[model samples]
Target chain A: MSTPARLQPGDTIGILGGGQLGRMLAQSAAKMGLKTHIYCPDPGSPAFDVSNTFTVAPYEDADALDRFAAAVDVVTYEFENVPGPTASRLHAKVPVRPGVRALEISQDRLFEKQYLTKASVDIAGFAEINSQEDLDQALQKFNGKGVLKTRRFGYDGKGQLMIRSSADGNGAYAALGSVPAVLEQLIAFECEVSVIVARSLDGTCVSYDIARNHHENHILKTSTVPAGVTAETLNTARRMAEQIVTGLEYVGVMGVEMFLLQEDGEERLLVNEIAPRVHNSGHWTQDACLTSQFDQHIRAVAGWPLGSAQRHSDAVMENLIGFEADEWHAALSDPNACLHLYGKSETREGRKMGHVNHIKAKALTEGET
Target chain B: MSTPARLQPGDTIGILGGGQLGRMLAQSAAKMGLKTHIYCPDPGSPAFDVSNTFTVAPYEDADALDRFAAAVDVVTYEFENVPGPTASRLHAKVPVRPGVRALEISQDRLFEKQYLTKASVDIAGFAEINSQEDLDQALQKFNGKGVLKTRRFGYDGKGQLMIRSSADGNGAYAALGSVPAVLEQLIAFECEVSVIVARSLDGTCVSYDIARNHHENHILKTSTVPAGVTAETLNTARRMAEQIVTGLEYVGVMGVEMFLLQEDGEERLLVNEIAPRVHNSGHWTQDACLTSQFDQHIRAVAGWPLGSAQRHSDAVMENLIGFEADEWHAALSDPNACLHLYGKSETREGRKMGHVNHIKAKALTEGET
Candidate 1:
C-alpha cells in the first residue's frame, strides 16, 4: 500500500512499548488531535491509561500485531529494541516510522558501531566478543581495560560488565547470560552529552540544543541544556546527528549520546550510542523550547512539517527516581519548576517515577564564557 | 467525609463533561501523573479518548454517578452548567471542587448578577424579566437597548437576543422560550478583556495577565496578552476577579469576562460574566505561561498549591472556528504558532475545532506601552 501524503487530525498512530515515552507520545499526538492505539504485553502499561485504544498482548503475537496494524494509519515504537520480526511484520502491513533499519542497527551494539563507522561518525574502539577468550583479547588491544556489553536488549548499565584489568575479564561473557557481546575501549571522558534530532519524511532535519547529562548509579539524574559545549563542538554534534539520520534514511527523532573528550585543550566528541526514539535527556524541551522532542517525533512520523527547535529558556531536567518522587509536593510548590509524573503505581528502586524541569532565564549564548 | 489532605499522584480525578476543556484538563492531570475518569453522557466524547476510564450515561443516572463517585478521589466539571442535583449527588460521595455553590451561582444569569452585586463588583444594570412587560420595562430602563438572555444554560450567544431598540424587544421573552431571563443595559465599551484567576483550596488566589479579546459575529476571535490596559486597570481587573472568587469560596480557575468602558477620560471595568471553569480566553497560557490555566485548575481542584501565573512570552490565541482549522498546515508550518485541535469528526460552520497560539518575544512588562 502507498503511504498517504499526510496524516489528518483523526488518523490513528499505533505505538509499540507502552511506557512513559509512549504515554508522553500519546499526549503529544492528542495535542495535535491525532488518535493513538497502544500495543503492549503488560496489562498495566502506563501508556494504556492515556490512549484512545490499547491491546494487552505479547509483541510476538502475530494475530494481535495484525489487528493493531490494521487499526492504525502508521506505526512507531517508543523503545528501539522492538523485535526485528515484529517490526517487519507490522511494516508489511503499515508504515513503521524510523524504519526497520533504524531498529535493527540500534538494537545491536556492534551493528550500531559499524553503522556509525560507515557513516563516518567518530566512535570508541570496539571489537566483537563471543567468549571469554575473545573478550580478553579485545581488552588487551585497549591496554587490558574495556567495557563489555551484550549486543542486544541492554539499557541503563544493564547486561554489561566493566573489565578494569585482565583478571576482571575472566568469565565476563558467562556473566552476561552468554549473549553475543561487544567490548569497547573505555575512554576517560570529561563529560557526557546528547543531541536530540528529528528527521521528517521529506528528509528535513532539526536538532534541539545539546543537553549535558549527569548519571547516578547508571541511571540519568539530570540533563541541563546550553550544554556549555564550544560553538564548534555544537556544530559538529549537529552535523553528526544529521549525517546519521540521513544515512539511515530515518524518519522520527533519534537521541545521539556522545562523550566530550578534552585532548590538548581542544574538545573532541565520540559517538557513544544511538536511541532511535525520544531521549530522556531531551525532556527539558517540553518546558523550555518552542517544540518538545516528543512533539517533534509525533510531527515527523505524522508527515507534518518540522517545527523550530528553538529554546526560549535554559532548563535543567531532573528525574524523580524511585522514592524521590515522594517529594512531588515540593516540586509543585517551586515557582520555576514544571513537574511531570509518569502515573506508575509502583516505584521500585531506580525506576523513573517522574521528572521536574527547572526553567531559568536564557543565557546570552552557548559557550559564551 | 473529609477530603484527603492532598491528592496523591495515583489518585483519579473524575471530570464532568467530555469536551475540549475536559480533554485538556485530563492531559494536564496526566502530566502530573494523576489518572482521570471522564464522566460524560456522549458516547463519542473527546475527553473519553484520553482518560483511564469513562462512563457513558445521563448526568441524572444515579447508578452511574454513584459508581463514578466511588471510583474517583475528587470530582470537577469542565462546564458550569452541570445540573445542580448531579453535582450535589457527586459531592455527597466525594469532594466536588469549586463546590456546589459555584455551580448554583454561575448556572443562572440572574443569580450570577446578584452574586456579583453582593460582592461589590461593578456590573451592568440588569433586571429580571419573566414576561414581555418585564422585558419592556427593563428595555426602557436601558433606553430601549439591552442584551436579553435566558437565566440558565446559555452559551456562545445562544438562548439570547440582542435588543438594539424598543422594536427589537418584541417577542424577546418568548423567543427565549419564556424562561427566566435577565436583561442588561448593553455598554458601548471601548474593548473587552478577561482575567483568569485560580483559587486553591487553602484560599490562595493567583491571576494571569489580562487578555484583550476581539469578537466576530458574537463569537470569540482572538485574545491577546499584555492586553495593553493601563496597569491601574489591570490591577483593578485582578482585584475584581479575586473578590468574585473569594465571594464564591471558589476552588478552581475562573474566567472573569469584563467590559472596559472609557468614561470621563478614565477606564471603568464592569464585570460581564463568570465561567467557573477553564475558559477559552486563557488557552494562550498553555504555551506562554509558567503554568497553564488547565494545569492551574487541576492543581487547585486537587488541593495542591497554585502555580505561578506568569507569562514568559506575549501571545495571541485565535480560535479555529470550523473551516478555519483547515489551514492547520499553515499554522503548523509557522515557527511561532502552537496549534491545538480538538478531535472532532465533523466540522460545521461556527463550531470550534481547535485554536492556535502565536507566541512572540516577551515585552518588558504588562501595559508598559
Candidate 2:
C-alpha cells in the first residue's frame, strides 16, 4: 500500500489501548489540534476520560476494530502486547505504526533477544524453553541461576520465576502454565538505565537524556535524568537505541531499557528489553523537556516531523502507586513539583495512579555534569 | 452555604463555554486526575474533544444547567460574559469559582472600572453614557477623544468605536445599538502589559511575572516575559493584581491588563481591564512556567493548594491567526518552539487557531534584569 499522507490538524488518531499512556498520548494529540478515538476492552479505562471517542470491546472483535479503523486516519497502540492477528487485521485496513514486526518481536522475550543480537546490540544470554528439560538445561549453562519468563503477556515482574539454583527450576515451567518461555542469565549490573528515543518516518532519529531508574518490588519507582553516567556511556546508550530503531525500521518512540555493568572500572551497556511504545521512564519529559515522548510518538506516527528531545530542566519523576496518590495534597504544596494523577477510579494496590516530576534549574545540574 | 470541601481526584469540574480556553482548562484538569464536563451551546465546541462528558445546551436552558450542576463538584467559566442569571443558577447548586461577583463586575465595563476604582486601583478616566448627550459630554472631558465601548458583551475590538474628535462622536451611541456604554479617555501609553494572578480558597494570592503584550487589530498577537519594566513597576503590578483578587474575594486566576505610561523618565502603571478567566497573554505560562495559568485556575477552583508560578525559561508566545495554523509544519521544525493548535475546524478570518511559544535559556534573559 502507498504511504498514508501526513495527518492534518483536525484528523483523529485511533489509539489501541485506553490506559494512562494512551491518555497522555490523547492529551498530546489535542495539543497539536488532533483528535483521538480510544479502543479498549475495559469501559473504565483511564484514557477514555480524555479521548474524543472510544469503543469498549475486546481486541479480538473484528467488527469493533473495523469501526475504529474506519473512524481514524492512523492506528497506534499504547502497549506492545496487541494480538498479532488484531494488528494484522488493522494493518490491512490502515497503518499500524511501529508496525507488525516491532510488535511481534517485543511481545516475545526470545524474539526480542534474537532481534537485538542480530542488530549487533548487546543483550543478556538467553535460550528458549519449550519443556521442563529445556529450562533445566539452560540453568546449567548459567550456573544454575536465571530468570525464566513467559514468552508472552508478562509485565512488571509478572509471569516470571527467578531460579537461584537447579532445584528452584523444578515446577517453574508448569507453574507458568506450561507455556513457551525463555531463561535469561541474570547479570549483576551497577544500575538500571533507560533511553527514550524517537524515529521519524524519514528515518531521522533522536534520543533524550538517559534516565537512571530505581525499581521497588519489581516495579519502577523513580527515573532520574542526567543519569550521571560518563559522556562515552551516554553516547553508547543513545547509539544502541538509534541502532535498534533503525534495524526495526520503526516510526515512533521506543523505550530501550539497559543494564550498566561496571567491569574493570569501566562502564558497559547491555540491552535489557525494548518497549515499542512510550515508556514510563520517559514521563519526566512532560515537565522537563521541549517535547515529551508522548508528543514525539504521536508526531512520528502521524508522519509529522519529530520535535526536539532537548530537555530544558533536570527532573526526578516518582510514580504514585495506589494509595500513595492519596497524598496528592502534599504533592501540590511543593513549588517545584509538577503532579500528574491518572484519573483511575479505584486505587488498587500495586496499580499506577499517577506521577510527580520534581524540577530543578538546568544550570545547577549541568554544572555537576 | 458553608465552604464546600476541596475537590478530590476524579471529581468533575463543570466548565461553561467550550472554546480554546475551556479546552486548555480541560486538559489541565485531566493532568490533575480530574474529569471535566463541558457545557456549551455550540455542538462543535473544541473543548468537547478532550472532555469526559459534555452537554450541548444554551446557558438559558435551566434544565440543562441544573443537570450540568448536578454532575460536577464545582463550576467555572471560560469567558467573563456569563449571564448573571445563569451564574446565579449554577451558584445555587454548586460552588462557582471566581464567584458571581467577579463575573458581575467584569461583564460590564462600567462596573469593572467602578469596581477597580473602589478597590483603590488606578484606571483610565471614564464615564457611563446613557444617552447621546452623555456621550457628547463625556468626550469633552477627555478632549473629544475617547473609546466608546458597549457596557456589556464587548470583546476583541467588537462593540467599540473610537471617537477621535467631535465629528467622531456623531451617531457613536446609536452605532453601539443604543446600549448602555462607557466612554474612556484613550491613553497613548508606551506599551501594554498584563499580570496573571491566582487566588486560592484560603485567600492566598500569587502572581506570575508581567508579560509585555502586543496586539494586532485589537487581538493579542504576542506576549514576552521579562516585560523589562523597572523593578518598582514590576512590584507595583504584582501588588495591584494581588489587591484586585483579594478585594473581589476571588478564587481562580484573573488576568489584569494595564498600560505602562512613560510620563517622565519613570514608568507608571494604570489598570486597563481584567479578564475573569485565563487570558490570551498568559499562554506563555504553559511552556515557560512551573505552573501554567490554566493549571493554576483549575487548582484554585478545585480548592487545591496552588503550585508555583515560577518561570524556568524566557519565552515569547505568538498567536496563530486564521490560516496561520496551516503552517504548523514550519513551526514544528523549530526545536525551541512549542506549538499549541486549538483544534478549530474552520480557519475563518480573525479567528485564533493556535499559538507557539519560543523558549530561551533563563540565565541569558535573567542576566538582562
Candidate 3:
C-alpha cells in the first residue's frame, strides 16, 4: 500500500451510502472543519441534510463514481456492502479508509468465519454449505441445531434460516434459496456485547469498553455501559478487537460483536461477527464517554490521533424504532436525556427512527460491579 | 400574538445568517431531525456546509424571503442585525421566534438600555448622543471617562470609542462617523460575566449558570464556568435575564452580558448589553452541560419544553482566533478536549476560526469556591 497523505480541515470526505451512520459521520466531520459529500442511490438520504454536497446515483455509474473520487480527499462507507468493483475504482483515485479487504471479509459469512478462525479468534462452530447434502452433514455434526445464514447481504436478522433437525435440513436449505451459506451451531449465551475499535493510518489502535446490548425482533433496542464483564473478559475483548483491526490494516472504526457464555464463575466470549463500520451498540458512548464513536471514527479516517475512549458516566441508550419516535416530545422533556433523531420522513415498521441516551452524571458504583 | 403551532421533528427551520453561529445552530437542529435553510448573501458562508438548503441572496430580496418563509415551519436568526423589513416580511408568513421585539431592542444600544431600565434591570448610567454637545455634557456627568458606541451595527470591539478626558469629546464624536451613539459611564468593574437564558413560546424560562468572561481587544477570549460570584449576585443575574426575556416576549435563547463590581465587600451586577441569539460565552455549555446553548435555542424556537441548563463539569472555553487555529493538532491530541472548528476556507487576522472546551469531569473544589 502507498503512504496516503493526511487530511486537513478544509478537505472534503466522500461518504458512500446515506443512512443514519453516514449522517452522524458527516456531523462529526463538520465539527473538525471538514466538509462531506454523500453519494448514494437513494434521493431522500438522511445524510444529505448534514453534508456539504451529494450525488444521487447508483454504484455502477462509473462517471458519477469517478467524479466523486476526484472531488474528495478521502473515501469511506457507512456499511460493508459496497460492491467490490466500486471500492476498487474509488481506491484507485483516492485513499479509501479501512481498505477493501475488511469489506470483503465482512460482507460474506463464509469469508468472515474463515478469516476469524485463521486469526485464532474464537467463533461459533460453523461449516460452509453449498448443497443439500452439505447442509445435512453439517447439521448432523452440529447436533441438529444450527443457524443457516446466506453468504452475503444479511443484516438485522434478515436472510437467515434455522436448521432444527436432520429431518428439516432440506426445508431449511430450500428456505435460504440454496445460495452459498454458513451453518453455525447456536450457543445459548448470557448476553450480547460489542467492542468498538479504531485504527489510524500509522497502525495505532484504540478500543472502547464493552457495551451490553439487548435486541427486540433482531433490532438493537438498548445498550448500556459498564457491561458487567469481569476485568479479564474486558481485556480479552479489547485485545480481540485490536487484533482484528491490525490484521485487516484497517484505518477507521470497526465493531466486534461477541456472545458471552458464563459457565459457573468462568466467563468466555465467542466472536459472533465483525462489522467493518460504526455499529449501533456503541451509541451509549455518545453520552457516557469522553469521545463519541462517531468522533473516533472520523479521527481515524482523517489520520488524526485517536481520542481517549474513557467512560466518565453511566448511560443507557434506547432506540425509538418506527412509531416510538412519536414520543420525541417526551424525550425532549427529560433533563438528562440527549435525543438524536435522523431526519427520516417515514416511519416504517422495525425501522430505527431515533434514539435517546439517558445519562447519569457519575460512574458505576462498586455494588454494580 | 396568535398561538403558533409547535414544530415537529421533520419540520424545516429557516435561519437568517451564514456565520459560525448559524452553522452551529444548524448542526443542533439536524440532530433533532429538523432541517435548516440558510439565507445569506455571502457565497462562502461557513453555515452553508451544514444546512439542508441555502439561498445566496441578499436579505432585502423580498421574493426569495417569501419563498424561504413559506418553506420553513419557523424562522429564526443568528444575529440581531437583520433588517426590520426582512423580519417583518418573514413574520407575515411564518412565526419568527425571539420575535421582532427582541430584535428591535437588541439591535440598537439606545433601545436596549431604555428597555432594561423600564423593566427595573440594573444598568450603567448612559446618555444618548445626537450631537457633539450631547457627548460633552454626558462626559462631564460621567466624570470625563465614558465609552462612546454607535447606536446600531456594533459588535465585538468595533464601532466604539473611549473618551478619557473632556478635551477629546469632539474627536470621539467624529470618530463615531457622526452616527447616532450612546455614551456609557465607565464603571470600575471587577470582572465580566454573562447569563444565557431561554424562553419557550408558552412562557417557561430557564437560565444557564453564569459564565466569567475575559476579553482581549474587546473580543471575547475565554469563558470559565462557576463565575466565582456570590449566590445573591448569581440569582440577581438570572432574575434580570428572565425579566428582559419576559419583557420582550422572547421565544428563544438570549445572552445577557454584565459587569460585576465588588464594592465595600459587596458584589453588584450591572447589565452591559444583550444579544438576541446564541452568544460566544455560552460555548462552554456544549461540553460542560447536558443541554448546550444551541440545543436550548433550537428547542425554544421549536416551541418545545426547555431542557435542564445544569452544568455537570468545570470547563474553560478558549477561542481559536485566526492563527490560533493552527494549534488544532494540539487539541486533537488531548483526550479531554472537545474541539469545534467552523468550516471557513480562509483565515483572517482577528477572525474567529474555532473554539475548544477543555473540561474537567468534576465541578469546582471547596477551596476554589
DockQ of each: 0.36, 0.42, 0.37
TM-score of each: 0.95, 0.95, 0.94
> Which of 2 and 3 is the better model by DockQ?
2
Q: Report, to 2 decimal places, the DockQ of model 2.
A: 0.42
The weakest ten consecutive residues by lDDT in model 1 chain B span B360-369
- Candidate 1: residue A121 lDDT (0-100): 93
Which residue window of length 10 is worst by lDDT in model 3 chain A?
A360-369
Error of 1 at B140 (Å): 4.0
TM-score of 1: 0.95
Best by TM-score: 2
Q: Which residue pairs in candidate 2 collide?
A: none
* Tens-place lDDT digits, model 2, residues B1-369: 334759988899999999999999999999999999999999999999889899999899999998988899999999998989999999988999989999999999999999999999889999999999999999889999999999998999999998898998999899888999999999999999999999999999989988999999899999988788777888899999999999999999999999999986889999999999999999999988878999999999999899888777788899999878888988888867888999988899899999999877442211111
The deviation in Å at residue B182 for candidate 2 is: 2.2
Any residue pairs clashing in model 1, and if so which? none
Please, what is the whole-model Cα lDDT of each candidate in the order they appear?
A: 0.91, 0.91, 0.89
Best by DockQ: 2
Give per-residue CA lDDT, model 1, range B315-367, as digits (tens).
Answer: 89999998998989999888678889999888889988999999874322111
